[model samples]
Target: MTVSAWWFLLVGAIVTYGWRAAGVALSGRIDPNSALMRWVACVAYALLAGLIARLIVAPQGALGDTALWMRLSSAGVALLVYFIFRRSIVLGVTAGALWLMAVTTLAGG
Candidate 1:
């Protein structure tokens, strides 16, 4: 890989590991069921949802090749599967992936 790529990898690794370490260090002091922890969890989930929405609306790389309808349809099916399966991660992911593949296959691209 190029120097810039290596630098990014190194920086990413450091930051990821640092956050993990910080979480671990704070875990003992923080109550998992506390209001503050619940708020943090909500914020984390919101951030994740925002990122997913951004990706669907304006993706990059290979995902960008997929049509907006296909992406939205997949998300809708995934959500349906998740709720139908009582929030089963495996089934939701499988449903979404299969739906995307089926749509792409039917589109002939």
Candidate 2:
């Protein structure tokens, strides 16, 4: 790679690690059970839910090409797998992705 590309990569790594280092340094002082922490968690979950809803309702890129019913069915299957599997995120995501791919392929989407 070019020198500029290497420099950009180095800078990106430094910036990413800088935040992580700062988080680690401050983690000891932060109270996980505090009201502020609870609020942050709630906001995080809300943002995640909103993003998921948007993706299912009006996706972009290749996902937008698929039918709404296909997306909704995949999401339903994912949720069912998630709950049945004791809320395992990895399993839920894998199930959703596989279901979408299978449906898209079979339906020629």
Candidate 3:
């Protein structure tokens, strides 16, 4: 809405795209099967798992207000839907969100 905000957005876009462009430039030379790549992949998965665990176990804000069992149940439903839909992330997340809302409202949380 302001000049400063526009400048900030422009800078953010430039920085984000700069790294992406560099990655694209270097991608041809990087070996997907290399040990370094494997390590990176493992680290990424570990970080994701840790974040998910934290959100479920000790969430902040609105989610924190919900009961632990509700959170766990939603996560279970999400996982089940994920597998049932052949690992479709969109469907899994949608089902989980819908389930969480329904349960929370029904239980008067």
Candidate 4:
């Protein structure tokens, strides 16, 4: 990239890091169990759930090529497996991704 591009990137990085440092400095003054913190956690989780749902229903890249039913089915199976196996998140995600890959391949789509 050009010098201007590098300068812009450097400035952006500093700004981002500044915000993080500000947060860290203020974090010590805030209670971990405060209502604001709880609300922030809930909002973050909601955003993540929304993003995942959007990807499964209307993906943008390679995942977009897979069938919706296939994606949903894999997710369902993953949840089932996770619950049945004492909530192993790694196993659940692995099974889910594998299931989606297998069914999508088998379906020829």
Q: Residue by residue across 1-109, what tens digits does model 2's lDDT show? A: 4577889989999998997897799898988799987997899899999998998999999889999999999999899999999999899989998999999999994
**With candidate 4 superimposed using the best TM-score fit, by how many Å does residue 1's alpha carbon deviate from the native?**
18
lDDT, candidate 3, 1-109, per-residue tens = 4477889989999998997897899898988789987998899899999998999989999989999999999999999999999999999999999999999999994
* Per-residue lDDT over 1-109 for candidate 4, one digit per residue giving the tens place of the 0 to 100 score: 4477888989999998997898899887979789998998999899999998998789898888777899899999899989988999998998998998899888994
Q: TM-score for model 3?
A: 0.65
Q: Which prediction has more favorable lDDT, 3 or 4?
A: 3
What lDDT score belongs to each candidate, Candidate 1 first?
0.92, 0.92, 0.92, 0.89
Off by over 4 Å in 1: 1-3, 23-43
**Which 10-residue span in candidate 4 carries the lowest summed lDDT?**
1-10
Candidate number achieving the greatest TM-score relative to the actual structure: 4
TM-score for model 4?
Answer: 0.74
Clash list (residue pairs), candidate 4 = none
Cand. 2 Cα-lDDT: 0.92
Poorest lDDT segment (10 consecutive residues) of candidate 3: 1-10
